[model samples]
Target chain A: MKIGYLGPKGTFSEEAVIKYTQGVENCEVVEFNTIPEVINCISNSLCEEAVIPIENSIEGSVNIAVDMLINDANGIMIKGEVIIPISHCLISDAPVEFKDVHCILSHQQAIAQCREYISKKFPNAEIKATDSTAQAVLGVKSKPGVVAIGPERAAVIYGMRIIDRDIQDVKENYTRFLVLSQKDGVVTGKDKTSIVFSVPNVPGSLYNALGVLANKKINMTKIESRPSRKKLGEYVFWVDIEGHREDEIVKSVLEELKGRTDFLKVLGSYPKFK
Target chain B: MKIGYLGPKGTFSEEAVIKYTQGVENCEVVEFNTIPEVINCISNSLCEEAVIPIENSIEGSVNIAVDMLINDANGIMIKGEVIIPISHCLISDAPVEFKDVHCILSHQQAIAQCREYISKKFPNAEIKATDSTAQAVLGVKSKPGVVAIGPERAAVIYGMRIIDRDIQDVKENYTRFLVLSQKDGVVTGKDKTSIVFSVPNVPGSLYNALGVLANKKINMTKIESRPSRKKLGEYVFWVDIEGHREDEIVKSVLEELKGRTDFLKVLGSYPKFK
Candidate 1:
């Protein structure tokens, strides 16, 4: 399978794609700068599959990913899942003792992830936000005594030294990535299915829609709402339930759900990773 | 009131802070690099209030804002609210047609907001993501034919000319900003309250908690769940209900909610903006 994902290289998305495509024959990675571009690349047959981060432990939801799936719900299905632990590194050119640095540069998310360490260790240093951790390293490549916090790969790619590592506030910080493809994904014995549905604009609508899953004892792992773009005051709910669509209960639940919701799209079902 | 917010200059946070402090006396805007810094600045008496963008219409929730509020529950309160319409502008060093651009640079959120326009208009151009839309302009400052999509003020600060205006996919795109301060905010007759609560690890816990508001006929504008750092298989909910905490029904609901939840934090209650 040829996999496409968001990157120029050295991004968390690239790492997820790599792990998801492990052991597949003739697996190649295609990188796009934007999430929609990655999805488009697959839709347009530039690649067979795409991997994108849907949520982080610290960041609630990746809205762009949600919007893209909702916007292009026609030919895609969730094929697999991967949750990677996030650990941020501080990279720089010259080794200045962490105290002498004046500005700390990294992605806004990285800046948020490491705020506690940055404030406590270097209270006076100005936090300079960058587009990406890799870009931040590039910005301070020529400057001495400045640090960029990002993935370890970015330091190697940008030829910056890791002055400090594991700076994120939460040690168990993980990002959940979804692998999407043009056709229905292969059903592994152990799997989870994700679907997006929108009920009619009335009271008890959502409750009735969720009732299908409840009747089957299908535990929902995640539930989120995104404004349905076509209309105001209407929303589509993205749901992850603990069963594959191929399962007997799941198939029945989906049938019931489809009847009740105005719009229902089965995004994908993939085996959950450990 | 002396106001501190996140900005170098020309950031959305600056605009929101200005809007919130419009009619206030002695409102001085002090810029900070990060949200935690804004909180710290306010906590240390450096500023009377700090404004931060807590949520965007396009992006679901600003998790950093929620996490910070939860972490500093006792030290801050929601003093005021401002809804600023987010309008993205295409900026470049030299005026040029959108089709001729080789690269389009912007902050991730800006890229997300202008997804439809960029995909439809400049399908072949490379989308380069930057830390801030301001930094994106700075990236292409010396390079011609490189354009950026960001706020108009960013173009002004970077000395870039506006190639196009109001390019966001939705005309009603707005970001909700919250004013945080040590003192309890002045409550206007018409107000809104925000709170965070974690339910008992039981099936009906969430339903019962939400029932308090539903029974009181209080409308909920927003509800989001964030993983609690304390334990595995647990989550905390951030809710924005449409009434002041001091209202009789709201107070009664809070009292009932306190008895049912594992823990509850009344982040703050402040006057809602139109």
Candidate 2:
């Protein structure tokens, strides 16, 4: 099996793929620079599977990933999922004190996750956003007065020293990563189905559509609205419900929802990460 | 009067403030590096008002701004809004051909907006993400082989040349920014009220909460779900509905909604951006 994930390496996405595969023999892992590229690789058959972060406890949905999975990647399905506990560390090139750091670099999401710490500790340090946390660590490796906030594994991979550990504002932060493939997973009793739909422009359109789930007594785990990309104020809602699509109740609810929505697309069914 | 916005000067946020203020005399416009800082300035009374992007046609919600407006900035309200049409340009230090560009620097959102253009024009160019589009333009000003994707104004502000114009994938892209103040706006007759709420963990909880709006014939302009920051499966829904909070119809709907929801917060009411 071949897997693709967002990386320069040492990223949570890479860690997710590794954790999902669990050191499977003969499994080859490839790295892409962006979330779309990872999905694109799977769409183009460059890789058989891909792992991408879909949501964070603190940051909510990864819009780029969700957007691409819905609009760009054709015939892609969520085969599995992994929830990785996230711990951000401040890593630098040397054993440097906090006062000596003049700049901090990381991905925007990582920077946001650690905002409270950065604001209080390095009030004057310049915050530079990079493409990925791993890229930030790579950039700090040759700079003495700069530090990067990323996974602790990044410091080991880049030969940098960990100046501080668990720097995220909320200590209970975790990212949910979805394993994508060309086909949907087979019926697993413990599974979750993800779907995207847009209701008609009517007063009770959303209420009617969601009523299908409420009527069937289906438990909705997540619901997010993203711009349909056509115009302002237009949105497509992504919903995660508890149960496999193969279940009779789930099938009937989706059937009713399809009729009420302007458009609907089932992204996939996958085993819920525990 | 004073206004704060996310800035290094040539960013869309700065443009938003300029467009919103529109030549108000003696108004001091201050710049903050991040969205939280911009909101923090308003919370700390460093600026009497602030402007921050709330949504994009392509990227959906600006999560940081939404999060702060909901959780951090106490007693702040949306006084007004500005809609800015976004068009990205390729900027470089010197007049350079597309083939000569080895690296492309931009904010992640800008890069994503122009993905189709960059991939077709500079297939092999390395893409670097920066904190802001203005910062990317600044980074490219001293580097000959690098280019940036940002507002056309950034090129002129940073003494750079525009290599290409209107490089965005979608020409219809626009960003909606909110003008925040300590007090909510008075009834403008044509207004929108934004609120965030969490329904109880039950099957029909969301349906019942949204029922408050549908029952009263209130039109919801937008609905987004963000992680409550408390748990993975939990979420807080942000809803934008027509009418000011002071309106009798809206007041009743909110009162009914408050009773149905576990927690609710009214961010503010403001005139609809024309």
Candidate 3:
């Protein structure tokens, strides 16, 4: 099996793929520069599956991934999910002291996660944003007085030293990555079905659509609103409910939602990550 | 009156401040580097009011601004809102052709917005991410073969020329900005109230909470979920209802919501921008 992930081999997405397919043998992992590319690869059959971060504990939704999964990758389905605890390390090529470092580099999200620590410790350092934390690690490999905040795996992958460990402001940071494949998972006793739907732009329309789930006593785990990408003030709701799509109640709720909503798409039914 | 906005002078936030306070004399506009800083300036009385981008047509919500308004800046209230049409321009110091540009710089959001345009026009250019589009304009001022994607105002402010105009991929891109003041706005008859609340982590908790508003026939304009920042799977919902908080129906809805949620914070009631 071939698994594609957003990577330069040291991203949290790569780490997620590793942990998710830990026991699987003969797995070939490929790296893509962006989330959309990973999804594109999945759709193009360049890879059998793709792993992408769906949500962060601090940052609500990974909009690019969610939007792509909803709009671009039509046939791909989420098969599983992995939760990885995020721990950012300040890495450098040389034995540089904290005060001597003149520049810091990382992805925008990583920089945001470590905002407070960076501002306090390296107020004078020039912050450079990169495409990915792993890319930052690669960029800073031969540069002195420059550090990259990335996963510890990045430091190892790029042959750099960790100048500081666990520098993120929030200690409880965790990212949820979804495993996407051409096939959706079969009904697991404990499963979650993810769907995206848009209600007509009328008063009480969203409430009426959500009532379909509430009326059937179905429990929704998450609900998020994203721009429908068609126009301003237009939105589509992404929801996760605690049941397989094959379940009778879940099927009925989806059928009722289909009738009520302007548009509805079932992304997938996957085993719940405990 | 002093108005604060996210700035290096050329951000959409600055434009929002200008449009939102149009025709007002003796208004001093101050610029802050980050959204939180702008909010802090308002809370600390450094500025009488602050304008920050709340949402985008393409991007769902400005999480930093929303999070700060919900968690950090107490006693601050939203006073008004302004909608700005975002038109990104490819700017440069010299009159260079698109083919001559070797590097492109912009804020990540701007880069994402103009992804198709940039990739199609300058496929080989190195993409650099900056803190803000204005900052990108500043960074490219002395560099040849480098261009920044920013508001057209930035080109005038920085003495740069627009190499390409309206380079954003989406023609309908618009950003919604909110004005924050120490004092809340009075009922404007046609008003909107924004509130942030966290429902208990139980099945049907959110459904029941929304039931309070639906039962009263109150129309909600927007609903967004942000991480509570305490732990994973915990979120606080931001809802914009179509009425002033002082309205009888709105008041009853809040009272009922307060009883059903674990945490509730009314951001403010303000005149809804049409």
Candidate 4:
């Protein structure tokens, strides 16, 4: 399998790509700059599969990944999912006491993930933003008085020593990554389907639309709304329902929903990843 | 008004706090470690108000901000929102060419946001994550061959020159900050209400609950689902509807919903920020 993911290396995205392809031999890892790029690569047939972090247990949803699927309704399905546990580390090249470090560098999400520890230990150090924790480690390695907060694996890859480990504010910080492909690789009859839709800017519209799913006794796993850029008083909704598109009930629900909204698209239908 | 937010200074959270509290005189900015801490500070009378980023245009949503409101439902209400445009810059201590830099640092979101730009311009540099962009700037400020991607303000504050500016991959990147207060801040009469609820695990339960709101002609601005921890199969939902709790229609909708769901709580009823 040729797998593409968001990475230069040592990123959570890279780790997820590895985990998802663990059973496959002769796997080719193609790194991209963003989730969308990976999706595009898969959509364009550049790679057989792509991995994107859909949501972090702590950070919620990654809209870009969802939006990419919504915008491109060309048969891409989520073949699998991987829940990767997150562990942030404080890394630096200097061996001086941690108190001597005057700045903490990391990605904003990492900062948020490790907020509690940083606040208690380095209350006064200037907090700096960087593109990634791996990059921050490089900055620290090249500097004399800086510390970087990232994953332990990132520290190892960047040749930096871990000054502190497991520093995330929450112990259960895990990211859910989706493995997408242009074609469905395998099917478990009991699968899930994702769809995006927009209804009229009037009351009762969404209720009427959701009625289709309710009437058919289908289970909805998730639903969220984002502002529609086309008009000010409009919104686009993303929904995850627990049934395959090929199912009789799901087909009926989609048929009924077609009449209730101005636009609707089934993002994908694939077997649920355990 | 005295203000509190999540910050150590120079974080996007601090930027959001400053943006949302625009033009308010004698506003003291207090920094806290967590979203709950910010709300607690406001609730305990340590700060008159608090501002936190509730969502991003690119990132979809801020889950912590949402969870904080559910837990601290009685004490705080979202008063207003700030849509701040985000721009990334590569800051370095020495005016070295972009190719001369061996590593780049930024917040994880920053890395995600500027994915394309970094891959195209400095594809070989190891990207590191940091706590915040400001910290990344500080790292690059002492390192001659490293670059940090952050807001332009950080470059100015840390005396690092910009090797490149406006490097974000997305042109429409924006973070939505919410202004929250213990009181409703004189309800504008026209307001929206937010609520969290848990329904029975049976199929069509959410649809039935939403049907009441639809039947009452109430429009939902947003809806999202998160796992409710107490039960294995149960789920909790967060919803935003276009009406005040005092409104007759919304009141009736809540009455109908209460009859169906096992648990429900009104998060707030503040005038919607335009």
- Among these predictions, the greatest TM-score belongs to 3
What are the per-residue Cα lDDT tens digits for candidate 2 across A34-145? 7778988888999998999889998888777888887854788888899999999999997888889998889778887887898899987777666689988998977988
- By DockQ rank, best first, the candidates go 3, 2, 4, 1
| Candidate 4 deviant stretches above 4 angstroms | A8-11, A73-75, A91-97, A101-109, A124-164, A229-234, B1-41, B50-64, B79-179, B185-188, B200-202, B224-236, B259-263
- Interface RMSD for each candidate model? 4.6, 2.0, 1.8, 4.7
Q: TM-scores for all candidates?
A: 0.79, 0.92, 0.96, 0.74
**Model 3 lDDT tens row, A137-183:** 99887799999999999999779999889888888899889999998
Worst 10 residues of 3 chain A by lDDT: A123-132
Candidate 1: misplaced stretches above 4 Å? Answer: A6-18, A21-34, A92-112, A115-150, A153-160, A186-189, A198-216, A227-235, A255-262, B6-34, B91-112, B115-161, B183-190, B200-205, B229-234
Q: Per the 3 Å backbone cut-off, how many clashing residue pairs does candidate 2 have? A: 0
> What TM-score does candidate 2 reach?
0.92
lDDT of 2 by residue, B81-180 (tens): 9999999989999888878998888877787788778878987776766667898899886787899999888888888888888878778999999999
Give the Å shift of residue A182 in candidate 2: 1.5
Candidate 3 stretches greater than 4 Å from native: none
> Lowest summed-lDDT stretch of 10 residues in model 4 chain B?
B226-235
Name the candidate that leads on DockQ: 3
**DockQ of each candidate's interface versus the true one?**
0.21, 0.57, 0.63, 0.29
Tens digits of lDDT, candidate 4, B1-274: 6888866576677888776667877888998755568777877888878887776554455565676676664557766655677778878898898668888887666776676687788877766656566767777756777888888887787777977777776566777677777655345677888788988777788888988887677878777665443332235788888877777788888988999998888766776665
Q: What TM-score applies to chain A of candidate 2?
A: 0.95
**Candidate 1, overall lDDT?**
0.76
Score chain B of each candidate by TM-score: 0.87, 0.94, 0.93, 0.82
Give the number of the best model, judged by lDDT: 2
